[model samples]
Target chain A: MNPTSLAPSELAYVPFVSVDNMMKNVSAIGVETVMKGIADYIEEDFLRWESFDKKPRIPAHAPQGVIELMPTSDGKTFGFKYVNGHPDNIKDGRQTVTGFGVLSDLSTGYPLLFTEMTILTALRTAANSALAAKYLAPKSSKTMAIIGNGAQSDFQCLAFKTMLGITEIRAYDIDPDASVRLARNLATSGLNVTICKTAEDAIEGAQIITTVTADKKCATILTDNMVGPGVHINAVGGDCPGKTELHKDILLRSDIFVEFPDQTHIEGEFQQLPRDHPVTELWQVYAGQAAGRTSEHQITLFDSVGFAIEDFSALRYVRDMLPKTGYFEKLDLLADPDDPRDLFGMVLRAEAGRNGEAA
Target chain B: MNPTSLAPSELAYVPFVSVDNMMKNVSAIGVETVMKGIADYIEEDFLRWESFDKKPRIPAHAPQGVIELMPTSDGKTFGFKYVNGHPDNIKDGRQTVTGFGVLSDLSTGYPLLFTEMTILTALRTAANSALAAKYLAPKSSKTMAIIGNGAQSDFQCLAFKTMLGITEIRAYDIDPDASVRLARNLATSGLNVTICKTAEDAIEGAQIITTVTADKKCATILTDNMVGPGVHINAVGGDCPGKTELHKDILLRSDIFVEFPDQTHIEGEFQQLPRDHPVTELWQVYAGQAAGRTSEHQITLFDSVGFAIEDFSALRYVRDMLPKTGYFEKLDLLADPDDPRDLFGMVLRAEAGRNGEAA
Candidate 1:
């Protein structure tokens, strides 16, 4: 694209919101503030959930991992996120998750923003977890148990501290060093951190239990016996068919709430439940049309198979803050020709810059 | 994402091949040369089509237009294209299509490269159309007819000229100005251009007839009687379920071929046919596992519903050519902190660049 001429043309300048920009923004506002802001947006969006055109994310499972596309539109704008999960990536010293997405104008079908979604997903996932927990967890919850501390531990801690006023955190990971790292990161986070040896130890005396274990298998992060009646389970990371975090009996004991039932049925902990399993949509709860945790003693579980709207919220948040931070560089994602019909000619010109001179 | 330290990290630098870089690369190579190179890649990949993980491109159809994600992987590298088709986009003094895409390593699920695919798609689609005509058309064929003269017409005309040695192109569109624009763009393209008064006039004496009309409705650019014996029909524009470019009788008379059956059955001209409509897979024929034109007089049809593999090949080729050009701007798509565990700290540090401070 002739980037110079695009400004004067009818084209929309899609503000690129990269991970660096998002991080810079997070640092400027502080992690606690960003989480609170994201939670507020997620809550606001969830409240008007009837306005969104939602669907189960489209996933492509590969031999090594899985790639997914989550798309949603709220009448006026459209958004989608492209993400990949390969746990083995960490063995090669790379992050287990990476993602990016675009938000476009629904009327013109032109992408107005492109943002890196790796860090943003962690943030959004954590925000969504805390948002659900706000509605489902015990009212006076002061202590939270986090089982499986990998890439997602820090954000979860940040969100809980910002929203629920949690001052103490108990963390457990299969790898002891991971728990040690989690403790060290949260050391300056103004919260008391406990390095528990097991999920049972982490959940002991905790008001809210959050599981974010990443394994392709259906592992029991929280079994029936370990969970208490008044506790709320914020289930993350068990987001694919063969991957689930909780035991079936544990899910059977709780009054399940889900992001989207069609997706939760295939991906969430509810995958093990029967087709006839009764559950309420989280959107309805947000709308105040459906009851949430009728009593403080009711056991509640949020089957969070992350939705596209959270990504939309993150992209918007990143876009609003990118200009202040120079953490992003623009790629000529569009072909801006002097004349749109002369696309062939413009390409020939770009080729000249690459291959020395055009033949 | 410290862009400078990113390349040395275990994660691959998915240096986005920008639109400017792509256009420069194509222009330097010349449209004909790039088309020839892309045509070779398309034929080679199509022959091994079964090796790819194929799914019909997911499309979000709106009232005005459609946005789509075309993804395919070869178990080694994963690729996807983000494209939008808004026919009225041109009326607002804009290109009717724009796109970008990525090629990622499946082993680590790392995005290896991000590229501008709007111009690349035009070039690849044109190359694909010409490649199909090479096998389906008679070996001695020359003249071709292009029933649509919009933005795509230039690429289609020039690609055929370069790949198939089509010396003349007969062009026609409902809007005479579009045909005039197409003719002007191809003035230096070396092909003999004929601006015909009607579709019938354009198809006359043409060995290969390509219909690339760009309306959402089922508008027939070719009638059964207009197509003669031994003609290769390149059906380009009837890509969505409700859109078709060729008359039903035209399909009835020709030996049909498709990119992927599961996709073409829903989007191509085959949507007008029975569910069990007998059509040959193009890859099987390229692999010598199936037949092409059985007789010299047999009419052949390549129902060209664009496939993900074409975009995959195009993205891979651009990735190779990007390093040869220094015009690309590095995008911070991934976060690489000195400490991977301290993602939150990276944000804190990146924000230091604010207020004219060095980040």
Candidate 2:
């Protein structure tokens, strides 16, 4: 009656992309090309936003930090990312945010892919910002002012260069060493980079501004006077409750855009305004149902507090690239028996195999 | 400027228990003994139930089945289980239910362990049922009738033998092959086994009755006339909305005990009852705040819907066993840089290493 008379089968294996292989894949295919590919997928998904099953992320909050699960399904494919935000982890040599994600088949509910998402998240976030800028930023924009240089700074700068053709970067951080590290990492990326002394100095003549500070509290990284007309603002750091980077006055002046209004109202810059504050859903603009940039001198804000659809697109991109790169390992993560009803029989076979018997 | 100048570090690696290693661990510690150990952890966690965070599982439903995420935390440690229920998966040589889980440190929000929970879920679910029986079942029981002899049948039978000293098993299933398979799997175990042609014959002399039928729709495998007095019924398979095994008349007469009332009302036998129907919480009984078995004439029913806390306890038990068994593999699942803020720098170093240059 033992259907699986011997050992484990191929059905038990799942594909896993580790950090080393993810980096290898990035190098195998150029990083800029990878980011552009992710950006295209994000835009494609956004164009059909009504097809998805969406919900706000589930979060477990602690005094020190929070861990969250962001899940979404598009009828055929389902994806989720497990992520954490711990601002105090920097002193102990840990990332402020780290993540991993899974994509599964909706029909069978079997996981098709598991990958390290810390690096992928940076790429997708940058790509999402650049994608928004393409719709809202001025046509001749060539320079970007990056305030609060951190781990995501280099990716954002490179993604802009790849997706929007930006050629110059003016970077600043409260700590000078962060700016130095960003410049050092981007040394050979073919963009003119300048280290600025203050936030005002960074945004002096740039057409686009990006604020990505890692503080857990409310801090004004950009004020009303700092944001000029016709300039696009990518606010990425204020993503949780009690976290905001732009002053309320700046928000009042800029026409805001967001991923999902329900979530943005609680975590994005919209949190500073009333619940009825008018904000555009990014998917609407991508779908051509809403106007993106109506005038030459309008202030456009992409209040970017990352979303699950972007992660889904990132996972989709990685899964598509696996065949070309061959950069994944098979993990024996599921138990499969020949006769599914005989799971206990399979275990007994394992014990027999352990005892050197060929039953 | 590179924090992880050479290669990956200890922090980048997370311990993973594959299906093969899980089988080896089960064999290393005897299955009966392992079930008993898991039962202890389940009871221990139940005693401090109020200290843990709880939530109804987040589910994504498809026409074929459903995928769910069950998450919980106890302030210090966090755990989540990813599971799916596709009753039709058996036709395609897959288990009806498959799962995997992760345990993490809440302070740093770093994953400590990732393990295959398909087999572990079976162990935990069986342990959970047996633990409930220890409280609700009549003290002088020696035989159990398991109505549906499918994947979870053997584990449930062995768990009772290990946890409650049950010495006889009378099993029945619609598909007679399933009962034969269960008998073959438990042949070496010391308990006497019998295959019954009818559900009525199976429960003729049994003190405890377990109904674990697998059907997505509602079906009454047991009726009011089938149930007798002083019988403790373990309703194991009626665990999702619109899926139940027992008749409503049986539930009306028995004093029902449940894991979590909110979840049980939606998924357990309580779904047949009113929303505000009275049911005793099993945790309260374990905590000595409520009663278990009161009189010889009273019929007790443990409406087992399964909860996130049991998965947490299962993960905790597996993590503790890993050190002694040494049956796990290390996976490079996290991106750890020497300088936590130098995530981009670490990727650049990987590029350098790939190009045969010293980082």
Please tell me which predicted candidate would have the highest lDDT against the true structure.
2
The DockQ leader among the candidates is 2
Question: What DockQ values do the models have?
Answer: 0.55, 0.84
Compose the digit string of candidate 1's lDDT tens values, residues A45-133: 88888888886677666778877788888877788998888877666567778888898876667787888788788889999889888
Give one digit per residue, the lDDT tens place, for model 2 in A159-190: 99988899999999999999999999999999
**Error in Å for residue A118 of model 1:** 1.1
| Ten-residue stretch with the least lDDT total in model 1 chain A | A1-10
What is the C-alpha lDDT profile of model 2 across B1-359, one tens digit per residue?
34346568899899999988999899999888888899899999999998899988999889988999999999999999999998899898888899999999999889999999999999999999999999999997999999999999999999999888899999999999999999989898988989999999999889999999998889999999998999999999999999999999999999999999999999999999997889999999998899999998789999998899999999999999999999999999989988988988888888876666543
**Candidate 1 C-alpha error for residue A131, in Å:** 0.9
Backbone clashes in model 2, listed as residue pairs: B3-B338, B3-B339, B4-B338
lDDT of 1 by residue, B1-359 (tens): 34443332545246866665565566556678888888888888897887988877777777778888888888888889888877777666666788888888887677888877787889899999988887778887789999988667789888888878899999998988888878877787788889999999999899998888888889878877788898898889888888998889988898999998889988999999996989998888888899887887899999998999999988777777667655465676776665555566555545544533454
User: Using alpha carbons, what is the TM-score of model 1?
Assistant: 0.92
Q: What is the lDDT of residue A172 in candidate 1?
A: 93
